[model samples]
Target: MGLVRLVVILIIAWLIYSTTRRWLASLDQKWDQKKSGRSEKIETMVSCAYCGLHVPQNEALQAQGKYYCSSEHQKRAESS
Candidate 1:
């Protein structure tokens, strides 16, 4: 009886340890993916043609083979 109880306890302990380890590893993978996504977002930025300012690609104005922070800057660059 004593041996059977010890074996059961050890099996339960091993199961708990394995489950916790897998959970932690999954959380770590999610964190790494989130960090890489943030880096990609930073890398997707564009520089303004008029003043060399960095702006997000979605917000920057694209025209005439150049990027600008605003439409006014795009017109200025085109006029000049």
Candidate 2:
């Protein structure tokens, strides 16, 4: 009876350990998938026409066929 109780406890412990290991493995796999799935492309860079500062083209302010680092610079350039 004592041996049977020990065997049951061991089985229960093994089940818990295996379940936790599987859950952690799945979480790790999901994290890798999320990182790889992003696959973000490199953005083109443009220089600010006013200050010659480099910024990503998508983030730069464009006016009169020129790119500026900020709106203030763009406004100043346009006003002049």
lDDT leader: 1
CA lDDT of 64 in candidate 1?
74
Report the C-alpha lDDT of model 2 over 1-80, residue by residue, as the tens digit.
99999999999999999999999999999998877755432247799999999988778999989999999999988898
lDDT by residue (tens digit), candidate 1, 1-80: 99999999999999999999999999999999999998888789899999899999878999877899998999899999
lDDT of 2 at 9: 100
- TM-score of every model? 0.80, 0.49
Model 2 C-alpha RMSD to native:
4.9
Question: Could you say which candidate leads in TM-score?
Answer: 1
Clashing pairs in 2: none
lDDT of model 1 at position 32: 100
Clashing pairs in 1: none
Q: Which ten residues in a row have the lowest lDDT in candidate 1?
A: 57-66
